[model samples]
Target chain A: MTFVLGIDGGGTSCRAALATADGAILGRAKAGAANIRSDLTGARTNIVEAARQAFLAAGEDPDLIPQTPAVLGLAGANVGTYKQQLEAILPFSRSSVETDAEIALEGAVGSGDGAMAILGTGTAYMVRKNGKSRPIGGWGFQVGDQGSGARIGRDLLEQTLLAYDGVREPSPLTAEMMGVFRNNPQDVVEFTTNAKPGDFGGFAPKVFDYAAKGDAVATWIVDKAVADVEASLGVLGLEAGDPLCLLGGLAPLYAPRLSERHRALLKTPLDDALGGAVRMAVRMFAAPVEAAR
Target chain B: MTFVLGIDGGGTSCRAALATADGAILGRAKAGAANIRSDLTGARTNIVEAARQAFLAAGEDPDLIPQTPAVLGLAGANVGTYKQQLEAILPFSRSSVETDAEIALEGAVGSGDGAMAILGTGTAYMVRKNGKSRPIGGWGFQVGDQGSGARIGRDLLEQTLLAYDGVREPSPLTAEMMGVFRNNPQDVVEFTTNAKPGDFGGFAPKVFDYAAKGDAVATWIVDKAVADVEASLGVLGLEAGDPLCLLGGLAPLYAPRLSERHRALLKTPLDDALGGAVRMAVRMFAAPVEAAR
Candidate 1:
């Protein structure tokens, strides 16, 4: 009857799964953003609330959250003091914090040797070999995060400005983007003044859609993004036929555009990162608790 | 003699010169940044402080500030409410505010038809014809500022990251930049998190210096910047042999690199923007206030 919890937290929302100690799925729940680095207190509150909601969804007592062991896969936990800070404040009987990418690697390939690149609003690459995680470029939107949705969208805006200034030939894509800002470069400038990475990422789907329709500017942007991803994969030492997963929102779009060698390495993930967190919780705390008997 | 004041206010500091009813310079003084858009209150305080200091430097009473007619050329005044806000409360008998570029145009080519390009931490363009000032692309670092020092320095960082990731071939320029951040991409990433445009602008000199020594990467970056500046000038409808002045801190570096068409238009500024402001003050307010009437 022992219970465990797995949590996947991102910049927008958090998801939690209630499971048996042996990793049987019970129920799932979702809550608000749990971006630890930006809003630790808010993340803590939402994580606990998600766990409570998960228990209730499983037709169990919300009170059981205190007894359940947990493994949390969270955005922003990998790079800063947020990991230690989160670990110390978690409500579970026993808990551990791992990067959203680390758990993604576990779910995408396995607990063994493999690699995964999560390309959503931002990008992060993780390689797990001999059970050690080697991370590359998740440096947020201000710098790093090449091939990310935000980066692609930002490139679109920069190109749009160039086209507006007649420095570059305008395409339908730039024309459409300018239209979104009411055909005013000043409006575009004002929008970027306070734009988060996610705000910029909102334009990424348009870039991809336009590229599919053979728009020249869109094609150019996508071509560069694909090359950047390929280079990052190459730099991460991803070999031919090594298990790799293109994870996150942009995964499906980027997966096909990658080179044949990289395409050959792509494998369907067994489960999403939430499942991986539950599996980890089962292995780390549940098994130890069981072994004591 | 009725005293007048000319003030040049920028993001870094404010400079003021005291003069007689005419445009002759007396003594000059400086204070902290008077960037009104970012810091309205601070700019107001510093503007008055610089004016007071100018009076003191000219061996006049600091209280003479209230009697002095003033014209200020200020950064961040053109695109926002800062100009109007500044005028409503300036501690002078009469005051007027204009764009730093406008005053620079006045200084470089006088009150006649002319154009000026300012290349510094950020870039701005002003074309004064038919007694009206036309400004283009002073839209801050997050968006516009195409040929700016900040943009050049930021390009260097992006190229350095690409080189580090093996996406681009490495060179001595990239090597030197990475060395500055202790050869760790993470260190470079962290530095950019809080870096101001000027902080990034700090690295622009190395880019120009390396271009002189034939660094391929530096040359590529500089060439692109030159093209952008050229394109902007063309967009501004700059004609052959039109009175144009290239102003600001990076002007000397960018001067020789520009196209011959642009070079032919380049003329040495008659005086700095501060002098332009003083000349304006003498014209606008000093003539009316003068006892010679």
Candidate 2:
């Protein structure tokens, strides 16, 4: 009669699911973003709220929450203190916290060896081989996240300013971006002075959209971003026969542009990170005989 | 017997000079940094303090401050509001605030038609011709500041991270920078997360130093930075026989590295920004006979 809860927490949103030990999902719920770096208190609150909503959808009494075991995959969990802090506040009788990348890898390969890359507002890659997993990139938008949407948006902004100064040739994409800032370099300066990664990431789709129309600057940015991704994928040592799944919002947009070698290796993930979290819980709470298998 | 005050306010420090109508310096004093964009209140206080100390050193009464006409060349004075706000709080009988680049150009060219480039922690160029001055760069460190020491430092940090990620070959300069960050990419990430242009600029000398010793990455960074400076200079339209002076902390460091064409046009400045401020005050307060010259 025991159930397990799974959570996928990210900078943009948090999702939760409830499932039986056998891995049949009974209910699912979602809440606002839960980025531990910027909003630890908010993330903690959203994480609890998402779990509660999932339990309610499953027709479970609120008092039964602490009796259920849970596993969570959260953005910013690589920072050990954040994971420890989030774990301390969980209401479940037993809970474990891991990085969103870890859960995505689990969900993509289903306990098998493979590689997965997430390309959302942020970018990260994980390669699972045998029983060990190695992560590359995703050091956050400031220092890493090389091929991330945020990086592309930031590059576009920089290029627009360069065009304004006549350092680089201005194209339609640069012109359109300048118009957004009222064609004032000072306004662009002020905008970047206080901008966060997600704020910059907000401009990525426009870049991609423009690139599709063959705007030179936009095309250059997209090409560089894709090259960075390909370089990282190469660094991950993705083999010809290895299964590779692209995850996150930008994945579909970028898929067609990947090189043929990568295209042949690409596979759809078996499940999402929430399902991966649930799978983790299933492994943790399964009977000894089942866990051994 | 009336005198003038000239104030030079920069991101690193503030300096003020007391000078006669004939431009003979009676006294000079310096105080802490004064950046209006980041700390307007601090800048205001430093500006006043520098002026007061200059008067005190010149054996003049502090009460004479309000009676003294002054011209202030300050960083971040390009924005009209900053000038307006600083003007409202000035103790001088008549005070005008202009960008540091403007005053530097005045000091360098001495009422003549010419151009001057300030290559300090930031980069900006000003050209004065036929009693009109136009500024070309100096769009702050975030979007512009292309040939700047801050940009070079930021680029070095980025390359160091790339080396850490194995995306780029590790060079001695990268190794030394990584050592400074405890050889941890995460530590470097933390360092850059909140770093300001000045914080980054602090590393520029080390880059130059290493480049002098032929470190590959350091040499590449300096070459690119110098090239950018050359490009900006080209855009500024430096004709032969035009007097050009390079100003700022890094100016001397970069002067010899500039192409021979630029070196031939480079001339020693008549004075510094402080002297230019005094000249401005003289222009505003000089007797008709002296003003005519």
Candidate 3:
């Protein structure tokens, strides 16, 4: 009757699930941000709190979180010693920490070999082949995230400044951006100075919308985004028929724009990342290792 | 017996010079950062401190800063209400706040109509024509500063990640960056997360060095930087023989790369920014404005 716990934590929120050892979900709950790299102690607290809430919702004592073996998919797990540092402080009977992208790939392609790209505010890729996992390009906004919504939005701002400088001809997209900023490049600069990746990602929709209408600047930006994504896919060694799923907030928008060759690899995800975490938890703690999908 | 003061303040340090009414520098001094936008109170403190030191060095009473009129070229003066705000809070009997680029332009072209670009960790342009000054692309690191050392280093990081992912072929520049980061993209990501523009700009010399040796990636990056700079110059409406000066830490590296048209316009600056400020201070407060040349 052992129950497994699965937690998915990100920069904004932490979610948890209580499920049977064989992977039947019983209850769910959520808590605050659990970005270990940014806030290790706080992330530990949030992870435990979310697990406690999930247990309570499952009609079990919250104190049982300490007895439950758990799997977690968390943001900032791949960089530095944050993962090991986090694992050491957890109260769960057994704890395993993996990047959010790893769980998402497992969720999308289900226990089999495949690849997935999370094209949200930031971009990260996860590939599983022959039971081995590899990660690419979750480098954050300062340097990486090439085909991400944040990158696209940043490109929009860059082009807007160029048009303002008469370095590039103004298009409808740039004109609208200028209007929003009150035709003040300083205002734009100020806005971006403290903008998080999500803040910049807010403008991605406008870029995609304008590109749909043939706005020259928007089209150029979108074209670059698509090219970058396709190029990353090539680097992943994904073939035309390989199982691939585009996850994250911008996935739907980018799906159709992928080159025809890579586009054929897209498939509906079998489960979301949390579900995958629960599935992994069950296998890691209860089921025989060979029984995993 | 009238004396004037000139101050140049930036993110790194604040410099001041004391001069007679005829624009002869009597003494110079330096203090800490006086970036008015990021820290008004601190900037005010540093500005006054620098002025005090300059006056003391000039064998005058430090308290006379309250009696002297000054023209200041500051890093953050161009953004928001910082200029006016700083002007109102100063101890000086009269103080004029101007962007650093303004002083640099005056320093280079000497009281006449012309243009200057400061190509340092950041890029900014200032044009003075018929006694009116216009600024372009001082939008800061996050949104503007195209063709800057900061931007060039950022481009190198971006390309390095691509090469690591196999999306781009490795070149000497990329390989060297990878080696520096110990062949770990995560290390690169971590290094960049908290990196300032100046931090990224630290790598600019390596880029130029590699470009000089014909590294494919470095050459491509430098070409883009040059094109962006040339484009901004074109937008400034400089003629083939306009009085143009390239200033700042990276100026020497970029000078040789300018197109023949812009190269023809390059001229040695008569003085640096602090001297330009002193000249302006004398003209504005002690000497006849028309006496400036």
Candidate 4:
């Protein structure tokens, strides 16, 4: 009964799962953001707590559990610099820490040879061919990340402000945004200041909701976002018939907004990133030669 | 002695001048924004006071000034509605109230048939043909004030916030904006809230400043702004030899940034909008037959 663990660590929260070599999920755990390089002590405590909770839920004694191979997909771990810090407290004998994007790509294609896009609080695109990976877009929220939810939200917010200032004409979308901010100018300031990139990205759904209700601005925003994302795909040299997988909270919401040309490239994965992580863990022991690379 | 008063009212201050039939200045006054519709009553009073001071400076009694024919070119008084409001307060027996754009256009071209563009806190374009007028742009601050100072300011502010949210990498421009905000997050709220559209527009010069100092982001912003403004010229169906005049505070700063295509259409005007107002006023009385139309 060989066991393996898979973890997906993000900016907002973390998810961990225990599975078998054959891909059966035995248990799962969830925790808050646990990036140690960003803040070591806090991340260590969060991981320990989440693991304990998962062990209790799985009806296993934490001390009696045997150490095994694990693969942790983490946001903000794109560079190799954070590996040493992660190795200090994480409990796997053979552990691999890679960007969350890599896990998403593997999960989407099962065995690479395709592309996966993550569109959460932020956005990134990853491609894998023959076990080697390449990234196209995912420069974060600053210079680019045009199609991400955060970008959409920021655009909407700016449009709303422009309307308020009478620099632009009022739009139906402005009314909806005002409603969301409770018609208080100060609340707008508060909302923007405290809003994480993903928090703004979360507003992507609201745009769709308004578009459905006949908001021209909302529709324009969604259309522009779709175009931007599609352009990213084109930049990656994605063929017309190539398979592409979408991941992240906003992916499902944005799926319908893609143009017909882009729609043809869509492929829903049978296994998600967590499943890919577990598979990677199992491969560590079963196929050591392949794992070593 | 016959007297003609020309006034130029803007957001920050107002200027009024008493000029003779020839192009000689007799006296001048400074006031503030009197576009009561925009909610700056105090500013309007300042303008009136400035005009009074101008009359005093001209060695004329303010109370006896009612006989002088005056023409005032004010900000925010576009065509249709606000023109009526301006007609009531100005002393000209047959005064025409128009956006500062018209005055700037007149100032740039004198009495010649030509086109002038105003790119201050807002933006507008006007053409004069046979002493009659046609306007091509200046749709307010919202949908299409492209290349205006306000748009540049808004873009910089948006980019700054995006950088702070960690959605994008830090750029030198972002660092400059951060320094402007004093590293205090709340400054974003204050600067944006307290800022007028023109104030943001005023920041457009700073972008030029940074670009001159070799900042890529600032240079990019300037390039994009010039492109946008130049494209707007096409809306008027201007020809290669058309007399195009550039006005407004940013016009001088952005002159070098204009594309050669737009530059080829350029014709330097002899006077500004205030001078145009004086020209219009003088023409109104000088040619009674045309004034009736």
Between candidates 2 and 4, the lDDT winner: 2
Candidate 4: interface RMSD equals 10.6
TM-scores for all predictions:
0.80, 0.88, 0.90, 0.55
For model 1, how does the per-residue alpha-carbon lDDT over B34-145 read when each residue is reduced to its tens digit? 9888888899999999988888888889887887788899875766577888899888888899878777888888877878888998887888767887777777787678
lDDT of 4 by residue, A156-250 (tens): 77666545544446678897787887875445655775576777777777887887787877877878888777766665556765678888887
Docking level for model 3: medium
Q: Model 4: number of clashes?
A: 21
Q: Write the per-residue lDDT of candidate 1 for residues A98-150, one digit (tens) a residue.
A: 98887787778866788988889888888877777888777777667888999
Local error of candidate 4 at residue A216 (angstroms): 3.7
lDDT of 4: 0.70
Rank order (by lDDT, best first): 3, 1, 2, 4
Rank by TM-score (best first): 3, 2, 1, 4
Pairs in clash, predicted candidate 2: none
> Which of candidates 1 and 3 is the stronger one according to DockQ?
3
- Candidate 3, residues B1-293, lDDT tens digits: the string is 36899999998999999998889898899999997877899999999999999999999898777888999998767677899999999999899998888887888888878899999999989887778988888777887898888899999999999898877889988998999999988788878989889989999989999999999999999999999888888878776556998998889999999998889999998899999899788767877643653
Tens-digit lDDT track for model 3 on A65-128? 7778999999778778888998999999999999888778878898878899989999988888
Candidate 2 residues B1-293, lDDT tens each?
37889899987899999988777889999999989888888898998999899989999886888888888998778874999988888888888888887788888888778899888888988887777888877777766888798888888887888777776788999998889988877787788888888888899999999999999899999999999889888776778999999987788889999999999999999987788888777776765638565
Local distance difference test, per candidate?
A: 0.86, 0.86, 0.88, 0.70
- Judge the docking of candidate 2 as incorrect, acceptable, medium or high: medium
Kindly report which residue stretches of model 4 are placed more than 4 angstroms away from their true locations once superposed. A64-66, A161-170, A175-195, A210-215, A288-293, B1-223, B227-252, B255-293
Report model 1's TM-score to 2 decimal places: 0.80
**For residue A16, what is the lDDT in candidate 4?**
72
lDDT of 4 by residue, B47-70 (tens): 567657777888877764566666
DockQ of model 3, rounded to 2 decimals: 0.67
